[model samples]
Target chain A: MARFGMVIDTKKCVGCQDCVIACKTENKVPEGHDRDWIVTESHGKFPDILMEIRTERCNHCSNTPCVSCCPTGASHIHDVGGVVLVNHDLCIGCKACVESCPYDARFIHPDGYADKCTFCIHRVEKGLKPACVEVCPTYCMHFGDLDDPNSEVSKLLQSRKYHVNLPEAGTQPNIFYLI
Target chain B: MHEIFTTRNNPYVDPIMAMWEWQIPVYLFLGGMVAGMMIIAGYFLFSGRHKESNCACFSIPFTSLILLSLGMFALFLDLAHKPYVWRLYTTFQLKSPMSWGAWILILVYPALIANILIRPSQWMINRVPKLSEIAGKIQQHHILIRNIGILNMLFGLMLGAYTGVLLSTLGSRPLWNTSLLWVLFLVSGLSAAAAYVHLVAKNKAESELLAKADNGFLVVELFVFVMMFLGLLSSAKPHIEAANLLLNGAYAPIFWVFVIGMGIVIPLIIQLLAVNHKVKHTPIAPIMVIVGGLILRFVIVSAGQYSHWFNAHFH
Candidate 1:
């Protein structure tokens, strides 16, 4: 099966939080609850310093701990595209999967359901990009199937040395960052 | 002291803000205990000689089921929206321990009810003269159900440990991430169950039963307590720092008074004195131990969450 992944070019990214607002509006995500955030890395001493910002969301791991630990089989990767999605109907809101997630990507919604980025599965079904991807002014986030050699994401991975978050976790996150 | 609580200047965050409160912890503690106790209760009901069986085997399941249901309700009440809470079951994720816990409860409830129903019926047949003959015959058919009780007990233990594992899985939460978390939880669960049993029976445990269950439970709890603290001491910087916040920070008083003094020291001393005096068993010792166990749960849940590591990025 083809695996969908994204390569985020942090060098080209501005950390404008457009992705955050765009995702919220598209998904109707609750206020005070964020599905994505910009992590600002600051360096240097005294007056001279530099700040680098990276936007983070679910990395859509291949070996997801959340799916492994879910007792009721509520957390699973979509067979068609390997997107992680929660089966709200089967979930008991025990928050085990939330606790197990390494990225802190998921949260308990006001309705007590676990919610996170689904890689915009609904939009993907319609052959459209995720809301964040559609809204990125810089076009820093690139999404495509990794299986096809000619795919954009596949091409980026072939050409650039990128970093994946928390590599030690061995989740094999599909999201690659062009650091 | 009041200034620390009122002002945002203190880097610490009250546990109430971070997650559940005293009531919820109490509820969790009770729910786990009931789960463990029911399993133990079910085990004894089937294996041991009927006449030799003590009140404990029967009472544990009966009381535990009642408390388990009650604790489940208390948890719901703690939530902001009790009515829509059913949505939680549907919003499942394997990565979320809360989701795992929800399913555990779902499985445990039916097992608990089955054990509760089976034991009494068996007891009635054994005790009531008129029904004794048919009851004995029917009891033979209950082998499958009895085996289910054994399975349930083992499942309950897993559920109980999952509670601690759930918290420990949060790598950023230093205090909870210790390897000792599972042991601490198991010991606490057993102790809490023993304590509830002690309290319910008015601490009137027979010497043999106390020797097997209560005395052993308290001693094991003490061992776990020592190991937990020692483990915290030996851990890396983040965990050690988190431990210090409990021993020396704003939560020290509660830790010392309720958790250590009342919960462990006093109860240990009483149990020791009883053992030394050759009393064989004493209600006072177990009663104190029970109270101590409950207080320990309250303190650990509260103290562990009393402070937060100030965000390094923010500072």
Candidate 2:
């Protein structure tokens, strides 16, 4: 019942992309592939400008369209903590899951399978944080079990005004950005 | 609100390069054509149109088997893990369109075989004496032949609709997310198949009947297409942009000239003329329909990928 999630404080993010490099290194995601990235938005005119920087990745939704669309069940949810992962051995590389994903989070790995952010389940299993969360210098990223009321991610959701990427998509994304 | 969101151009994550290429569109076109053929053949068999049924049954099964194999091969080439392709057969997922499509395609083969058995060719009976006996047994049981025809029609309908459902299930691509997509694909497939059969049928009556049928399908296809565009235009901003991509954007030339003009309009006019005895039947219109069908798949697949949420959100 433990739903793992992330809370990113956009106000604190610097758009440095260190988290991106960390994810690539940790996941060995290949030269031209990524597990996470940053999106920057600029609002208002030059005299009155508001620049917003936020890092993004797979939302790991409660209702994952990728999992629903995958023919081979290669894209599945990890039972332990509700983490979404792809079994490359079972993936036919049809790219159905890749297309179904509203976040554009999933990618076809060069070795031939659907690949996406795993929320570093490999590290989380070892009682450690994801590479992106660990490497973010500004500490803008927070990851924990959202189901646990005591967890930092849950507390952040209670304390902050946050918005998900695409509410209309109906995926119920776990990644929240603090306004 | 003048707000600008910029997504960094990262080919690594953006899916800017289409994962599906020429192979997918080719597979879709062939699959749709086969499905359309089966439905037409099945209808002829059930209606007791012996000459028409013979013409259709002669070519449908064998051609479908060959085309299905080629289409599967094309799909295999597109797989990153080609060796693991058998995993698609291991289990069934009700939620997955690809899973449904895989199962439907498997069922199509058996239905096609049954159809072939119901009416074996002279060459086939001559080559395999045992097949003649099987064909005789199958032909005697009118109920069995009727059942096969029904199965073929059902599977054909499923196959045709599934092609569009496959793309429409992709929620991220606004262009492919329409409810009308499956209907459009089904009508287009029927139209293409009718045109194809009209070209190949030896009997003038059958050929003319199919041409008339093709005209009906073409009209419905045009209407469904317009509905799809209008539906998308009325939805969210991203969906509107996706529609605009076909209406007047980068894909406008292909959408307007090829899919609408050459594919639907020109073929409709030609078929209408042929139906009215205004002009002699020519292969040009049927050939145009098939080509137009193929191009439609390619453009839809390509343009759907191009109509991404991030692209619309950022730009």
Candidate 3:
């Protein structure tokens, strides 16, 4: 009955990539695969440069293209809390989901199935924050129930200036970046 | 030639959805071959020219098998996991064009092959009246094959159009979302199919039949091109931008040099000149027309994909 979400304050993010390392280690993710990571978008050259470092994950979209594209129903919204999860057993690894995804979030794993961040459902079920959220020394990452009015995530949603990546995609991402 | 494209940023990411590097060419080749064979088969069936029809009978089956088989294989290659691709057939959705295509290939391919083999078996059985039972069986097969041929033709029509429909279905991708997309695909498919059959006929034996096929194909191809160009012009902003890319942007050289210049204008001019002069020396024009048609498919498939992806990313 809960809708879990994350809020990362970009101003506080130092682009240290601690969240990326924590995710990789916790998930046992292979090298060259970052479940959630930062991209530094730099405008202007040399002395006049302005860099916007964006941290991103699967977005746990409300209407996911990846889910629509998965022919075998390997990828689905988890029943418990609506987290996007890929069942490796059911996956045919056709890569249709990969192609249809506009955000470039999902990837074909070394095991030949679509893989993305699961919002650390295993940890959340155990009543702990995701590894990425725990390791963020800047306290940039915040995770709580979006539906619960008194929850931190809900309070931030009510008060903060935030943005979601590729909102035009109409996925209504759960991850909100407070710029 | 290589220098021009070297410094060019690929812009294609790990999941190459739209750069359309090789998939477009493969699609063009397959669609052209299928359409070419279909047109030839239809012509032979309708013409009732039994004796000379042997050329078409042999070539149609052979070409159909090669094109469709190769096409399906190319499609598998396009997949990230080629091994489990059979699941596509088992787990199918009627609403999705891709699922429809998978079903189309599954039903039509074996049917086409069986039909092609029947002609030779019938010929063999006729030589020996002692094999009357065998001949009867062959006759039954011939009937079945004929029925299958009908199915293949229907599938070919869908196969021709599905390429466009598949791309157009992505409504978010503005460049490909057009009502005209399906029509363009069908037209291109038919044109390409005609050329392929004509070429095959020429290779088998130099005959007036080949010339006739060439002439019919040229006329149909020209008509389709006109419709496709008009559709391109009348489409929404995304398709219009896609058209502009073909006419003026990065793909302009390929479009102008290969598709428009060689594929359309040159072939049209050749066909016209040959017709006006009543010259038997103008067989080269028909061949050129076929080549042009193939090139046109290549250009459109490639350009349509590139523009569609480019627009999506930028948006």
Candidate 4:
């Protein structure tokens, strides 16, 4: 029942990639594979340009196409927190979920199964935040149960104007970016 | 209030999914060809074209079993956890195309076996003496044979459509998101199967008929490809760019040269010529069709990976 989510404050982000590094280390995401990454876009003419930087990872949408396409139920929503997780043991490495992810979030781990940002469910279960959130130098990343009105992530959404990536995708992503 | 920037450019360039290699496409191509072959064999049985039916049936069961095994082997190679492959059959997920495909594939073998049982081959009889008695008993009941044929056709159609559906269901890849993909794949499979049958068929009339049928499938496949392109072109910006990847981007040469030219157009023209008696019916055209069909799977699978939602939004 707890819809866990993240609210990323792009305005406060410096794009230091601390979150990316933290995620990689915390998850032991294998060499050359990323659980999280930085995305930056430069806008306007060079003289008056503005650069927007944000970290990216799995959106963990409510309607996850990855789960729907996975043959063996390898990819499924965690019963407790609505978190999208992959059961590596059951994975056929078909890459169906990898391709179905609109965010380009999921990757085939070198060890050979579809993998992505787990929202650090292990840490969450232990009352700890995701590694990226905990490591954000700018405090731009917020994580908590969005369904809980008292949760920081919920409060952040209530106060800030935010957008989700690829709205046309219709995944209803849980990751919200506060502009 | 300031205007927020919305530009289609991501400064970072990361590789997308590369786990699916040549094995995946090879499996898809083989699975599709087998499905098409079964469908053709079933049709022959239903129409009481016993000679043609026997020709297709004699080969289909064994060919399907071998090819399906090879395809499954390719799939097994792609699996990260080979030991866990059996978990796929534990339960069926209605929403999952893969689950459907797995179950459908399981059903395919039974239908194919039934087709063979209805008309046991001399080789099969020699190998398994009991098969002769079973074939005799089954042959006495015409309705049972017709029912098996229908089952084969249904399973074949599902298998053929499942190949494209497997890719098309991936919402992230714009190139594979078209509704027309399944149709294109089905037609291409039929064309490939027909061509294969034409090559192996001993009867002159059956081979000629299959050649003609393949031409029709080719023409429909061409149309489906066009519709797929135009459908993507008319969609959102990302979809249009995805279409461009095949139309005029990095994949242009392969798409046009290999998939379109070698796969559809050339094969279509050669078949037309052969059917019209302008050229002798050599194995050249049929071989091209089969090659083209294989290449089609490669192009679609690889190119679909190349066409990404993220890439479309940025550069």
Candidate 5:
């Protein structure tokens, strides 16, 4: 019943995209489609400009519109850590989940079914970190159970100032960025 | 006074890309039109108009059944996993609008089929002699026929509203996230159906009556649309921006020129004149309404796609 979550440090992230490449290879995401990517944001004038580089993927929301909108229950929350996953066989490729995702996380796979980051549930179940988290060269990404107060993610969230993307969206996104 | 620049190059989700193409709009249009046909046919049947040789109910329901099947085919084509399309009927998710839509669509068949049984076609009766007996038996049972009419109208209303409610359920798309969308689509479908019935119904009195009804539906549809625009405009920044897509943004020209002008205003004027007996009823007006309904679907769906929830971090 653990609620798994990810915490990324915005200041430390260099946007190297090693995590993106690692995820594509680990998940075997089709060529031209990506399960994870990076975003670089900058603001302010000339000499006082500021930039924050962040890697992004599915937020694995607690209140997921993707699962709620899925007609066939093809998209679901995992029993173990509440990771969002898609049942490829049950999917009708309707794209209802794709359109409903506020994160713009879900996409229709080239082969048909809606696909997106699963938090590497397969790996998470095997007692390992998600491929993206494991391959972060800067050691900027952290993953652990959000429900467990003793977990690394919980500790970091408690001790650091952080923000979740699109808080107004009300998805209750699990991904947190330490500002 | 801070400036920010954040971007991603994902071709699918970024840059206001819509995963759905022409198939979705076409399906909605056909679905909405069929919905309109069924309700009109249902009302006529309830009024016991089938006894008259020139009544539209006897023919329109039959035609709507086929068109509903066509619309389902369009829906099937839009599915990414076509082979697994049957999964929709496997287990229904109560919270899902798509699930509700799937069940509503399936139930529509029985309503349409029972309406057909109220008066079986000659060829059908000829092919299966028992069909004549069955039709006759069903016709004599006034209660069952009326119930069938009620079912047709019920399903028709569900089908019509579901088309827009489906999109409205997607809160991510601000343009479609409105309480008024279902009403707008339902009225538009009704108007389109009335226009079509007006165009083809041989019953002169009924056709003229429907022509007037179409005008009323068109005005109500215009009102619903304005309410939807005002609803979006009065909301958050993203929603206001979403409304602008059809108001002043890239989607404006087609929405105003085609959907509002040619689709509603022009057709309503023509139908008004025709109903008043000022001008002979031309096929042009009805056709415009039908085409306008189709374009309305296209515009709402396409414009809604361009309106996504703003990603604060992604810009």
Candidate 6:
């Protein structure tokens, strides 16, 4: 009954992209495809601009359009922690899930399966942090059960002023960013 | 100036989901065209035109079988996981338009085949001797023919609307978000079919009749186009950007010239002239309508893929 999510401190990210590399290497994502990426957003005038560094991936929303739009039920939520995962064997590679994702998270793998970051469930299940979470030089990313009040992700979200991306989308995304 | 830069670079989702290309559009056009054929044939059947010496419905059903199969082949080609195509039939996904389409597509086959057996051609029976027996058996049950006609029309409606709904259901693309696309594509399909029947039907009366229907459909399709454009332009920033892609972006020339000017407007004018007996009916007008229908699918599919969520900085 665990709900997994991420809480990242954009103030401390430093835009290093180590997490991006760690994800690619850990997942063995095919050439020319990255399951996750970094975004450097800046706002306000030059002298007073505030910049934020974000490492983004599949939000694993509570109501996922990708899963709903999948014709073959190839995309489903894992029972372990509500992680969205794709069953490559059943996938027809119609790319419907790819088009339905608002976060622009998924891509059709070269081998013809829709793919995205799995939240490193293999590591997460083994009581190890996701590769990206483990490799962040500044300890900016934290992964834990968002549903547990005692989980680090829940505590971080409770203690900080945070927001999820694309609130207007209403997907109720699990990932939270500390402003 | 507020600015945002992302290092996301997957080919399928760099700026948008560009994986759907010409193959998907071709399949949609053919599906729409087949939808048109089945509906027209069913209408003829319902009106007792099937009893006529040489009703266009007789020939249309036969051609629809081939055309629909060809369209399915195009869809098959677009499947990245070709080996697993049958997986579509394993489950009926209530939320997926494609699942609805897959089931509808299969149902269409039986409807079409039944229509063909309603009056199988002598030439076909000569080639396939067993067709005679099957045709005789089917013709025995008058009620079945009526049911087949209804099935054809029902499936045709779904097929035509499904093409647009297919694109519309994918909320990620701002360009395909509007429900008007369903009505737009259905009217376009009907117009395209009417034009095609006008050109190819053996009966001059039927041809003339379809010419008029095509004119009406063309008018509606034009209105739908305007509504779709206005709907997108009036929405959120991403939709406006998507509409601009057709209005004045790289796709503007093709969208304006080929889809609107040549496909809908010009053909409607010519058919209007021909219908008034002011000019002889030439193959040019109908051909333009058919080609226009195709080009519409292409423009929608390609432009839709290029449309993205608003840039974070701009937002």
Give the clash count for each candidate. 26, 0, 4, 0, 0, 0
Tens digits of lDDT, candidate 1, B1-315: 011111111111121223445665777677667755765666665564222445566556667767878887877766543454666566565566666777788888777655555446455556665555543454576675567567667777877787677667655455776777767767667766665555554224434444356556666767876777678778765567778766787667877776667765676676666656655445665555556656666666655554333222212
Tens digits of per-residue lDDT for model 4, B7-116: 11221224444557898899899989988998998888777775454465666667877887899888788776667789899989899988999999899989988987
Off by over 4 Å in 5: B1-11
- Model 6 chain B: lowest-lDDT 10 consecutive positions: B306-315
RMSD of each: 6.2, 2.0, 5.8, 3.4, 1.6, 1.5
Model 5 lDDT, residue B167, Cα? 95
Ranking by DockQ: 6, 5, 2, 4, 3, 1
Q: What does candidate 6's lDDT look like per residue over B175-257, in tens digits?
A: 99999999999999998889889989898899999999999999999899899989999998888999999999979999999
Over the stretch A1-179, how does candidate 1's per-residue lDDT look in tens digits? 98999989988888888998888899998877777777666656657665556777888898887777665676788986899999776655555565456566777777766778988889988999999999999999998898889999999989998888766556788888886
Quote the positional error of residue A44 for candidate 1 in Å.
3.4
Span of ten consecutive residues with least summed lDDT in model 1 chain A: A91-100
Error of 4 at B276 (Å): 2.1
What is the per-residue lDDT of model 5 for residues B1-315, given as tens digits with 9 covering 90 to 100?
243333344555666657888889988998999999999998887888777888888788788988888888888999989999889899989999889999998899989988888788888788888878888899889888888888999999999999989999999888889989999999999999999899899999899889989999999999998898889999988899999999899989998999999999998898888888889999999999999999999899888888977666544
Clashing pairs in 6: none
Per-prediction fnat: 0.13, 0.64, 0.15, 0.44, 0.73, 0.76
Off by over 4 Å in 4: B1-13, B51-54, B311-315
lDDT of 3 by residue, B1-315 (tens): 011011111124332335344655576557646854664574454343323545565557766777777876676666655677767766776445666766766766665655455454455447754455643464565445456556556666777777667666654444455666666656556655555554555444534445444555556555655665567668655557766777678878987787667665666565555545565434465566556656666665556545543212112
| Best by the lDDT measure | 6
Ranking by TM-score: 5, 6, 2, 4, 3, 1
Tell me how far candidate 5 lies from the true structure as C-alpha RMSD in angstroms: 1.6
The TM-scores, chain A only, for the candidates as listed are 0.95, 0.98, 0.93, 0.97, 0.98, 0.98
Docking class of 5: medium
Off by over 4 Å in 1: A147-150, A158-161, B1-24, B39-54, B75-180, B200-208, B225-257, B278-288, B291-315
Model 5 error, position A166 (Å):
0.7
The DockQ leader among the candidates is 6
TM-score of chain B, candidates 1 onward in order: 0.79, 0.94, 0.75, 0.92, 0.96, 0.96
DockQ score, prediction 6:
0.71
How do all models score by TM-score? 0.75, 0.96, 0.77, 0.93, 0.97, 0.97
lDDT score, candidate 2: 0.86
Residue-level lDDT tens digits of model 2 in A81-172: 89999998899888888778877787877788888899999999999999999999999999999999999999999999988888778899
Which has the higher TM-score value, candidate number 2 or candidate number 6? 6
Chain A of candidate 5 scores what in TM-score?
Answer: 0.98
